[model samples]
Target: MSTAEAGRGPRLVPVRAADGRVGWSLVAANGRRLAAAVRSYRSDRELASGICELLAERAVLRFVLSQREDRLWIWTAHLPARSTRAGAGGGEAVARSARGYLRRDQCRQSVAAFRQGADHVQRLRRLAGGAFPSSAW
Candidate 1:
């Protein structure tokens, strides 16, 4: 088990690559990615959007992730519901739509890069969200 896995707290983190691209990932305490959740973006806004999508709420939606041949794929599934009818089999159903992403898009997250981006975003939020008093503003 990685340190991040053993460590407690938010499993997901935002990271920046050497090329200065930002990405989000689910990392372990050892700082290794749990899966290929890292996908880089040219700007922080794009990265934030991706993060939102990943963290977005789902109603009766469950996503299954799989890896094959150095690539990652996600398939959407929905919870089985009852129609107020008897003999209705309600179980996990596989989705027809499946999407695959390249492995290159998912690199192991670095603690340094993640901390840098996290700090920058948090600092921006504090300043822009009026965390300071009106007099300080």
Candidate 2:
């Protein structure tokens, strides 16, 4: 039986990225990644809070697992919060589609990454003189 189906399902795991960056991801039971941080986080606390916020805001997330090129893989997406309140007085819904993961697992991770990516883009806009180039390290 798939580990996920064996009562474990998907879970958020603390990840120390290959470049030594740190973040969180919701992984399948087989230890395959479902979704992950777009970049990385400076601290674990930030990562935890980030994941929590993602769950609270986003309403849709997608995870796919399959075999490709002789390897098992995952693809994931975290769609933006739905605009249930849209109406004549409301402006047109802004487009927000953030997909992550060289490996994808589940919806929660995708949402977290989406919001995290938005935060990174905002950081880019506020870059000052010689402010470390980019959010990517």
Candidate 3:
């Protein structure tokens, strides 16, 4: 594991594949360590929606079972603009629309959609009975 400092208290370590893709782990001052990998796909709204469904499963498992507030935050990090089209406020607009329909107070649905867009890597981790540590979301 390679380590670098993140801000004041935590350290970040990257978990890399032979192909050079990286997943990360965050080590906090209190000894809490979280790790997760990130992956991006071609911009397709349908694929994005499917990812959200998978993430909802993970959120239920991670947050509800572990009682972790950080799960929601980690879930959001999975979304990043993968294409210029999606980047031109499209992804954000989609997310905003989802949130609007779900109602802001319904944290579960909001998080579920975020998973759809960004949390496939985490879903894999969950399937393997593991967790991804992320600072995004």
Candidate 4:
């Protein structure tokens, strides 16, 4: 999964799977809308993490969707600063910067977990053929 800037929004494009299926997600900054599409998932968790990774890179905000032990979290990074507020006190701004970026870390961890889960489910489905239920993920 990778993110590419598209117009005013961000476009997320994923590589086609072995079954010739592609998934995509798009989000506009300023909290406009969220769009997602999924095709074939030979395994339940095939592209779980991928979706999150794409969103994290392009989103200014994200929504998480998961079930039971299988969790999927989504996040968007802040858009580039368009302006700097004057008289905001540079000292305070500097202090805030020292806090580091918690949001970025959260997004990264969520994507990693989702990726791991997807890989596990994919292997299970492949081994079990069509015996595994789609809801198992």
Candidate 5:
């Protein structure tokens, strides 16, 4: 069940892998996972700071949806490179959908939900086990 169905609101969850790598996942109100950090942080402190950085740059962050060679759709949120940096390519992807979608519309819906949840985030928590919330699966 989604968070809403489970009597919870959407929230950002900070997680730590068994290897001590940290990352964040955006969980939707319905309990579905929208997106997660593309790369893991070295520590919880770094994960927290990275989240702060993303929030500071959120206004300028860009969202893109694309199809993989496997024919699955995915979305990514990135920070565009400075225009003055001629050698720079596209911005680096910071977060991506937690899983691929079978259709473009499904991917777009996830992105839309991600935007809403992210903009109005009310709670942030780390699961007791430091893993993605089982409810999110």
Candidate 6:
């Protein structure tokens, strides 16, 4: 198993897409990517706001693990509804694993590792000009 899978905590790393849009990833201390934003943001301020929202809702967020038809297992994080009113099943997917796993056990382990470290996630400071050099899709 990799160091990240060994229960190491994760960090929030800024990433730049091919189109130059910026996003963020939850990466293990060993540099293994765990989860990432559902969509890219055009600016760091937007990215920071997104991160803040996620962090603020972390307590009520739910994590789900599923297997695709191709048999690849993956995990997704969802945000709960904002109100207790009827028809408020607002479980919107906000973050997902960076990659799919080959086995159900591995997928479960990834989820466990994520939960183990999510509460204490560290993030790098924003750079000047809002440019993140780490290339990610």
Model 2 ranges off by over 4 Å:
1-7, 18-20, 60-137
Residue 15 in model 2: lDDT: 69
User: What's the lDDT for residue 102 in model 3?
Assistant: 26
- Model 5, range 22-63, lDDT digits (tens) per residue? 898887776678789988999877876777666556678898
Off by over 4 Å in 4: 1-102, 134-137
**Tens digit of lDDT per residue, candidate 4, span 18-134?**
776655433323332233343433443556554433333332223333232334334322223335787543221000010112355554664444343334433444444533323
Worst 10 residues of 2 by lDDT: 128-137
Q: Model 3, range 5-49, lDDT digits (tens) per residue?
A: 222334334445566444444334454443333442333343344
TM-score ranking, high to low: 5, 6, 2, 1, 4, 3
TM-score of each: 0.36, 0.39, 0.27, 0.27, 0.76, 0.73
RMSD for each of the candidates? 12.5, 13.8, 14.7, 17.6, 6.0, 6.5
lDDT of 2: 0.44
Q: Of 1 and 2, which scores higher on TM-score?
A: 2
Q: What is candidate 1's lDDT per residue for 29-100, written digit by digit as tens?
A: 444444333347899777655544432322333444355665654333334444658866563332212134
For model 4, the local distance difference test gives 0.35
lDDT per model, in order?
A: 0.41, 0.44, 0.37, 0.35, 0.73, 0.71
**Cα lDDT for residue 4, model 2?**
27
> Per model, how many backbone clashes are there?
7, 3, 10, 2, 4, 0
lDDT of 6 by residue, 49-91 (tens): 7877776677777888898888899998898877899998867
Cα error, residue 39 of model 5, in Å, equals 0.8
Better of 2 and 5 by TM-score: 5
* Regions of model 6 farther than 4 Å from truth: 1-9, 122-137
